[model samples]
Every structure is written in C-alpha cells, then in structure tokens.
Target: MPNLNFEFTEEFALKMDQNDPLRSYRDQFYFPKVNGRDALYFCGNSLGLQPKSVKTYLEKELENWANLAVDGHFEGEDAWMYVRQKSKPALAQILGAHPHEVVAMNNLTSNLHFLLVSFYQPKGERTKILCEAGAFPSDQYALESQVKFHGLDPEETIVELAPRAGEHILRTEDILAKVKEIGSSLALVMMGGIQYYSGQLFDMKDITAAAHGVGAYCGFDLAHAAGNAPLKLHNWGVDFATWCSYKYLNSGPGNISGIFVHERFADDQSLPRFAGWWGHDEGQRFLMEKGFIPMHGADGWQLANSNILALAAHQASLDLFAQAGMEQLRAKSEKLTGYLEFLIDEISGNSGILEIITPRTASERGCQLSLLIHKGGKAVFDSWYAHGVVGDWRNPNVIRLAPTPMYNSFLDVYRFGKILEQSLHDFA
Candidate 1:
C-alpha cells in the first residue's frame, strides 16, 4: 500500500478503505446503532462486536440442549466431552502454542486464580509478587486476595512497578532493575501483556527471561493483547497466561477464556493445583473413583466440564481468526492505527488539545491510541459520541480509540477524526 495522506478527507479514507483487504470482515460483526446509524465503534479494545456466525453456532448448541437434553454431553454432533478439544487447534493457531499447551475453559480472572493457586507458591524468602501498578482493577483485586490468602502482607509481598512521575508508560529498564533488586524475594512476576490504559505492549520475552533468571515464574493477563497482538507465549517461555475472548477476539461478552501452560510443565504432576473431576483422566473419568487423576498437560488445569455453548461461540470467532491469520491482521492493524494517529496529529496540529500517550513506535504498542485531551475534557469527548463516534473514555481525561483491522474500516477512523475536530470546535 502507498503512504496515506494525513488529511482528514473523505476521498483519502474511502480510497484506503477500498484498498483494504480486510474490509469485508467488517460486515461479519454487529455494530450497535446510535440513532438509526451505525456507530463508529472504536472500543473493540474493551468489548468486540458479535460475529454474525456466533448466533448460528450458539443456536445449534441451544437446539441440541433443547432436543438432546443430558445425552447431548455424549451424543451430540459435536460431543461435549470433546467439545473443548475442538477449539484447541483454532486457539493454538492464534496464540502460537501447541494444541496440548492451550485449553479453553473458565473466564479470564477465574483462570488467573486457578493458575495462581498452582504456580504462586511462596516459600522461604521467595514470597514477593511483582506486577504493574494500575493494572485492571480485577487483576489488582485477584492479586491482593491471593497475597492475603497466603497470609502475606500485601504491602510487603506485592510490589507494583509504575511509570515515573509525569510519565504514562513503564520502561523496560526500570522493570528489569526492580526485578533484579527484588531477586530471591520474588516468587512470581506477572503483568498485562499490554497495558490496558496506556496501550503499550510489554516485551514479554525479556520480562519472562528476567524473571526466570532469578528463579521466578512469569505470566501475563492477556485480556487486551490476545487477539490484538501476535503472542508467542510458548516461545517466549511464558510459564502460564490467561486471556478472555470478548475483546479483539470478537467473542461475545463474558465469553469463555483460555489458559496456556508451557509444555515443559505439562507432565509435572507434583505441581499443586485445585483440580476437579473434569480434569480427571477422560478414559476413566466415568469410573468416578475416589482418587483424582488429572489428564496430562493443560487439560489437567481444567476444573470443570467445558461449557459447550461457550466453547462453540468462541470457536466461531477463532475460525475467523484462523482464516484471517494474526500476521495479516496485525499488518493491517498497524497501518490502520498509524493512519488514525496521523489523522489525529493532523487535526490537532497547533491546537495542542489532544496528546497521544501511546508509544509512537509501532513495535512498542498495539492498535490503540490513547488521546489525552488537554484543554477539552470529558465534555468534548461526549460531544464526539453525540455525533456517533463510539470510542471509550477512561477516568479523568483519556479517550481510547482502537481501529481493529479485522472488523473496522479506515473510513471509520476518518469519520472519528472529523467528528473529533467538530467536537473540539464546539467545545472551544
């Protein structure tokens, strides 16, 4: 593709959208309406649009539930016993992990808790947990509860790495230095694969390697990064990770989440985990003996029988992911986001009302561009929404716009820029 002019002009946006290969994918999602018009939704970083195929996939499950009843667990066209397995390949393709290394199960936070129970054993001096400060509130809550559960003081056992004064992004050097300083006291180091508010993509390989150098386990909450970035969790030596499918994955709200356990730890039965019958050996699971025999590998982490309907709905979105491929999706993503950045910069030139807080380097960030409005505040952002622009607003002053390449068109970004300009003028 040629360089896109930074002018917020319809002709330029239309031409770019016309040339976009992934443009057709936009029709696959259901965009909510504001007032008889399709809302320019840029909030896929929070909740993704529903895939058209999702309802069809879910309807099949509902029909089977209605007709087949309890027998559907073993007799449906897609056996529920093996329903989770069906999603394994498709999910592995997106995550760059082997099918055996990934399992689609409970929601993201619940899996985080499950993984913590198994991985976060604080012994001797190695009882500290280091994480990014200002992580998602749910993560903070879970981390605090976990620390308290271990009878450790949250202040002493939990260390939060934060940005420097007046800065909005964390530096890798500072994080590494902190990890080394904590050294033996650190039991586990976990962080968001991408910062939720700042939109900075952390260097997972380096972070994990740093933690491992000190004999600490490293993991990630991939809620924002899963489908938005190319993740090589296995290759990066990520001990374990969890992510929800709703955001960039296009699975509906509260969709089934997934977990990744490194192949190295797959056979480590000595590791402690709170297991259930569903994790028991499938070959003899029906025997229902008193002993708990977990299936080998990531499946062993499962605590209950898979939700077949949720798995099917997630599978529908995964099919689209496999079809588009992450590399291509990311390629278009960078360009589309770069285009949005350029347009924003163009419109804000000399205005000094909006500041882009996300990293300027494409390699250091995802598709999201967090705009910190200077003079204008939430009132200005609200006016943009009034005109059908549907980005998200963080507390205080940040407006997050994510141009998801899989389902968002360049025209949408262009229209957002235009509306934002009008909003600024009106607010002024």
Candidate 2:
C-alpha cells in the first residue's frame, strides 16, 4: 500500500529486527500484553516499561531493611545512609555532568523550586520570569508562585513566548530573538528542554548563551529529554535543571528526580537558600548545632534523608543506563523514531488527515513523534488503544508515541504501522 521502494511487511520487519544491535535489551524489560499478545508499546514518553532486574534489585534493599532495622542506614550492601550516592556516577555520564554537579533528590518540580529560591532572585527592574507559553502546569504554577512570593503579580512578572499564528512548534531563532529582546528585564529563562506535546527539542546550549548575554539565568525542565536525548548540561553552561526518572529512565512511578547545578556555584553556599539539616556538612551533622553549614556541591541541596526504597529502585535503572550508555542508546533511538516517521508517512500519503507535528530532522527531536489526527481525533486514538497499540493522547487531537530504544524493537514499529492503518480504516 505504501508507494515506496521498500515493502511494508512482517518479513521486512523481522529482517530489520534480526539486525538490530539493541534487540537483546528488549528481553531485559517486562512488557505488558493485550489479548495475550505483547502490546505494541509506544508509551515510553509517558511511562517506560519495568526493567526485569528491578524486582531483584528492590528485594536486596528489602532484605537489608528487614534484617538490619535501624542499622540498615550504615550496614548492608547498599547502606541507606549514603544510598543516594550510588546513582551519581551513572547520572553524571547520562547528563554530561560532574558527579558533584548532579544530585538524586525529590520530584522534578520540588527541585525546580529549591533551585529557583537561589537562582530566581529578582532585583529591581530585572524582576521578570520568562517561560514558554503552555509549559507543563506544574512549571507554570511554580513560576507563578515564585513571582508572587517576591510580591510581584504573576500577570506582570511572568513573560511567555507563544508560537506564531497557525504554527505548531517554536523555532530556535524565534526563542533566541525573544531572549535578546527581553535583554535586561528578563531575570530568568526556564523552559522544558524538550517540549512535551510537540516533541520539539530546544537548543539548550545556544539558548543558555543568549540568556547569559542578557544577564539572565537559564534553566530547563528536562522531564521528557533527560534519558531521551544526549544532554551536555555541563559543557552547555546551563545554570540548573531538573528531571523525573519514571518516564524514559525506566524507573517506577514517582521515582526520585535528578538535578544539575553548574560547578561554578558548587561552593557558593553564601547564596540564599532554604536550608535543611541533611544539607549540612555530614561530618558535623550530628552535632545538632544552631548554625547551618551547608555541604559542598549539589549535596548541599538535599532537604531530606534519602528515600531509601525509591533510591534502590532508581539505582536499578541507572545501572542499566551505565551499561548501555547514552551514545549507543541515542544512535538507535534516532533510527527507531525515524522508522516511525517513515511508517506514518506511508499510511498518510495522499491524505493529509494525520499530521506529524514533531520536527522531521533527527537532530530536532528525541524518540517521540506527535501526530495530529484531523478527523475522528480522539476517537482514532481510542481505536488505536483498543487494538493493543499503547500510546498517549494529548488534548485537542494529538497522539504522542515514543518507541524507546531501550525496550522497543524494529518489529514493534512495523506492527504499530499495521495497527495504525487498521485504526484509520475503521475510523474512516
């Protein structure tokens, strides 16, 4: 049916699968089945499939806790007292950051707020916070409250850049131009590293340069980009960032987030921050003194004792990342996502009913592809889901599917193509 040089067939899919280098990694995860067949899972952008090793990894911690009781904090293969440190080296490799620059901590928004208290200090006329319009609700709320906390009205203090009329995504030049225009007035530029709904990857390095040129701080919410893209946070000079682990990292629901603060501020404890005892110097932490002496680097940002159970689960995933490595993962991600694009185009050839809103170039996106279904809209998505195709639907007729390289296969993309064609035929 595809007017192409290549045929879309199950045998063709099998050939591609046989050649894939990461194909074995698929067995490392537990797939959810529908109607007794492995579901065509393209939902890694929302929630990644569980790693098979996660159970055994979690069980080790459970054993430690049950046997050691309070002593578990200091004794065991993974001692709870310094449990969070286990993920830092792997996180540093994944994020292109120094181990000292990254910290495993609270949820994404919470870390954003904690970093904001130090970085989003607005003085006099440089009191505005700039972010993408329609940013994730939690980010918008955090920015709004941070503005109001400074006795500034959100309506006036928060600045937003919306895509032009009829445009589905923002351009890099447009974003950089706006940053140059905001100039001195913009106190901070915080946006998602990758726009969630449209699957647009922002030019973080260039944007950071532009913000710095204007004397404004730069930060990113990398919830969708962290494990999905190669993020050189340290080399890019990004001031700060936060991301959750549940999505692309294959960690379980509400797993703890990671943060990156540039090494320049690693020892600047003089900066104003909301302090906690866990952030105090570990050597004298038990002294229980009145004065708070913060620890060095991102460890200083910790507010509470490690969520031991969650850290154990998170380490289970980061371990795999360290083994597979981001470079190899990203190489396959581009090909897998490109194949998804090719299949979508084959299905939507002459008819313009389905629109791919994500950028076409591999460099401009991660693994997710967002489709705008013109007719039947949400109904089309429902039909797809009913047929064992697992993807997420955004509001106003958008279907976002991500065939993650870690656990997804070439055959999965091909089978999804078949399912999508059937869904369309039924809806049409």
Per-residue CA lDDT of model 1 for 277-371, tens digit only, reads 89889899998888887787899999888888888889888999888889989999988999888887777787878899998888888899998
- Per-model TM-score on C-alpha atoms: 0.97, 0.97
Q: Which ten residues in a row have the lowest lDDT in candidate 2?
A: 1-10
For model 1, the stretches where C-alpha displacement exceeds 4 angstroms are 1-7
Candidate 2 overall lDDT versus native: 0.89
User: Scored by CA lDDT, what does every candidate get?
Assistant: 0.89, 0.89
Candidate 1, position 156, lDDT: 86
lDDT of 2 at 417: 89
Poorly placed runs, candidate 2 (over 4 Å): 1-7
Cα lDDT over the full model 1: 0.89
Error of 2 at 274 (Å): 1.2
